[model samples]
Target: MGSMAFSKGDRVVWNTPQGRTEGTVVERRTSDFQLDGQKFTASEEEPAYVVESASSSKRAAHKESTLTRRS
Candidate 1:
């Protein structure tokens, strides 16, 4: 995904095991990271977004291609 950058506090939606979920973008992760003992792969060319769930407040990392910025 090129030129798709999301800033912190941005509202976004993504698909999850429970179906579509809404959340706020916590940050952009260009480097690999581990959260809650789960490893996430990321790169500048294909960055991942760390987001906080709106309903549960749970945090998870998702690829940019998987996220849609909410208006």
Candidate 2:
């Protein structure tokens, strides 16, 4: 897998149950952390992005491979 390259405020899109959802890159997590009692293993080589959905206004974490940067 490729490394994470997204930064805060970056426009991105990812697949969802309904369809493709657009969002902004809220933060980049490089170290291991937990969210809502769920453990997330992240590192410099495999980071996770915290994104805020534009339509639902909800926040979620996602891997870089699952996101596509908007032009």
lDDT of each: 0.91, 0.90
**Which stretches in model 1 have alpha-carbon errors above 4 Å?**
none
| Deviation from native of the Cα of residue 51 in model 1, angstroms | 0.4
Q: What does the lDDT read for residue 36 in candidate 2?
A: 65
Per-residue lDDT over 1-71 for candidate 2, one digit per residue giving the tens place of the 0 to 100 score: 65449999999999999999999999999998876677888898889999999998888888898999988
The TM-score values for the models, in the order shown, are 0.91, 0.87
lDDT, model 2: 0.90
Give per-candidate clash totals: 0, 0
Report the error of model 2 at residue 56, Å: 1.2
Model 1 Cα lDDT, one tens digit per residue, 1-71: 47678889999999998899999999889898999999999988888889999999999998888899887
The 10 consecutive residues of candidate 1 with the worst lDDT sum are 1-10
What is every candidate's alpha-carbon RMSD to the true fold?
1.1, 1.9
